[model samples]
Each structure stands twice: as C-alpha cells, then as structure tokens.
Target: MKYDVAVLGAGMVGVCVAIHLLQQGRSVLLMDRNDAGEETSYGNAGLLQQEAVRPYEFPHEPSVLLPAAFNLRLDVRYHLTALPKLIQPLWSYFRHCSPRRYESIAQEYGHIINMTLACHQELISAAGAEQLIRKVGWISLYRTAKGRHKGLRTLDAYTRQGVNFKVLNGDELAEIEPAIKGHHAGGVHWQDPWIAGHPGQLVKAYTNLFKQLGGVFVQGDAGSLKRSHQQSWQLRDHQDTLLEVDEIVIALGPWSAEITARFGYRPPMFFKRGYHMHYQYPAGQPRLTRAVQDSEKGYMMTPMDAGLRICTGAELGLRDTPSTPVQIDRAEAIARKLIPLGERLDAEPWRGARPCIPDMKPIIGPLPGAPGLWCAFGHGHQGFTMGPATGKLLAAMMTGQTTDIDMSGFRAERFKKP
Candidate 1:
C-alpha cells in the first residue's frame, strides 16, 4: 500500500505531524516500533512550558561547571566513557551558551515556545482530552534564602519578557502547599504553562483522533527506509510487509539521527537521558495540588495519575547504555523531606532520552538534497510541548502554504560546516 507521507515515529511529534498532514488532506501512515507516547514523550515532567522563553543553557561558571564535571552533582551526571564521543557536541553546546549567542538562540527558541499553549489547546479541544490537562502551572521551589535570591535574579529577565509568575515567600509557599514539610525560602509559580496528569494518555487521545480522521498507525522499523525505483520511499512493517510513500518525515526523536546518518546527513545530535519514578501518598498525607520542582536539588515532583512522579535532571550517557539512576536516588531522598511519599508505585525507574541540538533549536524542515524527505527532531526538552506547533509548521511547509512563524532559525543546515 502507498501513503502520501510516512511519519516514522509514533511519539508526540510524529503523531502530531500525522494529524496535521491528515487535516491537510494527505494520507499519512504513522509508524513506530512501540506504541505512541510510550518513549520520551511518556516520562517527562508533564509541563507544556509556555513560560520557558529561554532554552536551558550550559553553565560556564566554576561554581556550576566544576561540580557537574567532577561528578559531584546530583542534577547532572556524565559517564566518563561517553565524554570522548560527546566532547565535540558538548563543546559546541557550550560555545552556543555564550551570553551573546545564547540570547540570539533564546529569541529564536522563544518563538516556538510562545506557540505551545495555543497549539496544544487546539489539539486538546479537538481530541476532547481536557480532563488530562490542568491549568494551574508548575512551581519552582527553593529551600534556602540564597537560592530564592538567585531565583529572583533570574525572574527579572523573564519578567522583562512578559512571563507571568508569582513570587511566594516561605509563609506563602506553605499556605499554598501545606503538605510540604521543608524549611523552604520561597518559590516562583510560573502561571503560563499547563500540566498533564497523564501525558501518555493525552498522546493516545491525539492518536485516536488521528485514526478517526482517516490516518493509519502501523508498527514498523523506520531504519528499513529506502528509496524505491519510482523515487518513493519504501519500508517494511512489523510483519515484513512492504509499504511505500511519496514523502517521509523523520520524527523518530532520539533515534532520528540514525536514519538521517543513513541518508548521509549528519546533524550534530545528542541525547540527555532522564529518569522518573512514581510514589503514592501515605494515609492522611495531603495530596499535591501542583507540580513542584526542587530547584536547588534538580528534580521535579508532579501529581500524576499513577501517583506523585519524581523526575530527575539530565544525564549524559550513550542511549543504549545501562541505566545509572543515581539522580533518581538523590532526588527521592530530597523529595521525601519535602513531601510525604509512601510506597513506590513502579517497581523500577522509567528512563528516556531527550533529543537535543547544540544550537538550542529544533531541526524542522526539508532535508536538503533529499527530495520528498523532511526532518523534524532534536527538540531537546520541548518535544511534547512543541509537537503540535512543529507539526503545523512542517505541514504548512510541505503543503506550500505560508508558515505561521519564521522558519529560518530552525533549518537543518545550520549545523553544516562552510
């Protein structure tokens, strides 16, 4: 069978791409090895971060870099073995984090971040998944007066950018979340973003909406993609059944680099692995009404459908390497002091790799020199947040329509050497 486009990933981004293409009267085949949203899309902090105007930058200060480099920090851990392979991309990432370059990247990234809420809203309303969404935004909690002061300093820039936030003191923070038992200094409640109770379920809802609108979902290996005699792309499904398509979209998240490399396009791609574990509240312990991030400790706890999910920060390692969940262990220790967490819901920690680019922008456009091929990956931490917006942009470009925003900054050729 033939399709107008074969989206080679069933995560949030690929599913959104398929939905957008289907809406534009294109026959889309959404293919994935696993079920939709069960990968990186499943185990995030579940934040649709509208207020995250700036992308996360590499810290250059000795205070921050020394600890992370020497493996003395719980927030960021790097495998010494992976450093040899990762140095090039990490250096580029650090170079991009220079104040001048970082500002430019932030402006470019903010364009996409600004569109997240509206795009997600459209899909949420269309898919009737309002029950999964919570408008009460996430909070960044600080345990020390010095940390709160630093947070206030950071807020000035966001405030200048018109990001909405409420500065809560220790008393006010306690008032809002009385269950928290830490001697907290304060918090910054970012009011622009939305939280998801079950992020995977939200993606499933969108997938169901796509299927209802005549899109097809198939289990297939995207690595099998090849150009056929008729200049169309062909790939075999799980049953080894061949399927062909006129156009193909590489939205395979962290796995996208493998497919792109096969096509002789090497965009500097890296992955930041993270882990999450859910815990239920003990009897008489108050339930958390909002998702909270322990800013200094570098972990977040969200009220998930399974239970209170404790998610860790970035871990630099090979994608297929054995899970070293040291961050989860540290986060759990700190989280226990903040809130009463009872029994662990998941027997094991769930880990996923986030696809990232050094320039802090996603590669979302056509693959240069590869006709009928498109690339959309390297979303870093915002894949789930920016999926719909990116899908609409990619669909617009594919259909030869006017894009809603500028596409120059997100081109795939940005990483190319002159």
Candidate 2:
C-alpha cells in the first residue's frame, strides 16, 4: 500500500517528522536502521535557546580549524589511513569561517534560533513530556578575560538580534549557583527553554505517539529511491523489501550525504564528533538546575534526570579514530576548570558524531532530483534543539501549507554547486 509520507532515519528529527505529519492527517511511515535515538540525538547538551543569536560559525571558528590540527583536542584529527577523505571537508570548513561568509550564514541562523525553543515546547506538550523539560535559563561562564571578551561580542550579537540575556557578575553567579566554585571573570545569563530529560526518552515518546496516532513504523534501511510512473517513490530496503509512498522525507542525519547523492545532489558536509561524559554525584552533592558552558574550553555541563553531564566540542576528521581516553581526559580537565569537584564526580564519557555542514545551518527543504522527496538534515550541534522546528517546517512544505517562518534560507539546494 502506498503511504502519504515515508520518513527515513528515526532520530529526533525523523521521529518528529512522523509526529507532525501524523497530526496533519497523513499516512506516515517512519523507519530507521537501528534503535531510535540511540545515536547523536539521544546524547547531546540538550539546549533550546529561543533567543540564540550567535550562529555556530563564529568569526574565529573557520580559522581555528587549521591551528587546531596540532591540538587534537581543540580541532579535527584523522587517522593516517583516513587523511585522504578528510581533506575536502577540512578545507571547506576553513572557507566558510571567513567573516564575510559567516556573517551571512549567521543572519539566516538567527531567524531559525528565534523559533527553536517554542517549537520544542510545542512538541513537549504534544508528547506530554513536560515533566522531562525544564525552562531554566543557561549560564555561560568565563574563566579568562579573553573568554569574557568573546562573551561580550556574543552579547553584542544577541543585542543586535534582540535576544534576551542578563549579564551577571561573579558574586551574582555565586548567589544563583553556590556549589559552583571558581573565580569567574563574569558570565552571561540567558534564558533558554531547554529540556533536562533523557533525549532518548523524548524520541521514544514521539515515536510511540506517532504510532498511536495511526502512523506505521517500518524497520528497514533505505537503500535507494526509484521514481514510479505516477511520480511517487519506491524505496528499496536493505533486504530488498519494497516500500512505496506518495512523498518521501529524508530526515536522515549524518547519513544524509549518502542518501542525497542518489538523487543527484552532493551536499557539502562532513561529520564532527562530540563527546559527553555522564556520572552520578553523591546523594548529598549539590545538583545544578541549569546548564553551564565554559566558553574558553568549548564545553558545556548540563543537568539532566540521569546525572550531571559534561559535553565537549572535539571535532575530529571523518576518519579519525573513535574517541580515545586522552580525548575524554581533555574533557575531564575542562570539567575540573568549571566544576571544582569534577575530580570527585568521576564521570564516564560517551562520544558520538554530529552531522555538520560548512555554513553550520540545517538543510531542511526539498530534495534536489525527485520531485516529491525532501531533505532535513545537517543540523550539527543543534539537532536536538532544532529537530522539532525543522520537522514542523518540513511538514508545512510537504503539505503545501505556509510555514510560520521564512524558509528560503534552509533550502537543501542552496549548497549545490552550480
């Protein structure tokens, strides 16, 4: 039987597409290669900032990649065998980091960030997962004057973009988080309507809700797409199983590059691996109510139902070895810098790859070749934060409804070579 829409990749975004499509009275089928949300979506900082103004490609991010080559912990690294495959993405990264290009991308991202938190909350209510979410604002701490200066610049961008924030001094920070120890130069207290639950739990809840709302969950890996004479899509599964649908949505995250190629569109993208360390504190230890980012170290500590999590930005080349003890050790060192008792916490680190594009904005529009196919991936670090928002927008496009926000910037064809 042909379905209305078949969404590939059952991660946060994929499942969200399922739920949104179902809500619109469409016959949706969601599929994934593995258990839902176990990959990148399940483990992340889980921040949702409605007022986020700064884009991922800050002015220094592109140039930092080159200098980061020497310091594996700071930038992308590759195994000797993987060097050939890593060159193109590495160069493209630096190219996008220029101020002229980064500013343009940031402008587009600013609009997206404006709606992220609200969309997450709508999903939270739709899934009845409010107990799993927390509206606590985010705090970014700076241990150095340079980091503080960077925060000021970020604040300037936020101000220009009209994002809300409360600049806090060290003493004010102490009053809010007394357990936090360290002489912070200063901090930016920004309110982000973020979730503090198991992201995996939220994904499962969405999937379950979709199924109950009359959606089908297909368990297969989509191999390629064959266009039918009627202009529909026939998806070839791993075991040669056939599934045909009226429309197809490619919400596949990291693997989107592989899938889109069959449709004659080669996205300019790569994988940037990030790490998260989770550990339970002593029963009496103070628990943080909000998330904190140590700006200088490029890491964040988030409070979740599971435990306090310390996640770091360790971008490795696609061929780099899986995270090593030393890589996690670097995260531990940064954790100690932010949390004085990090040594006592004894957190164990978990690592995963985040799908990234050069411009650092999510690709969330139509597929290039197949008329009925759509693309919704490349969210990178903000996949969890942007998943629901992207899904709602994609659903609008698929059904020919108007989107609340301007979506011309997120077109998948934007990165296509002329």
The 0-to-1 C-alpha lDDT of every candidate, in the order given, reads 0.91, 0.75
- Report clash pairs, candidate 1: none
For candidate 2, the per-residue lDDT at 22 reads 86
Per-residue lDDT tens digits of candidate 2, residues 36-133? 88888887887776755555652345456455655644323445455587677667776776878777777878777777777777777777888877
Q: What shift in Å separates residue 5 of candidate 2 from its native position after superposition? A: 0.8
Candidate 1 clashes: the total is: 0
Positional deviation of 405 in candidate 2, in angstroms? 2.7
Q: What root-mean-square deviation over C-alphas does model 1 reach? A: 1.0
Off by over 4 Å in 2: 58-67, 72-83, 224-231, 236-242, 319-321, 340-348
The TM-score, computed over Cα atoms with residue i paired to residue i, of candidate 1 is 0.98
lDDT comparing candidate 1 with the true structure: 0.91
Best by lDDT: 1
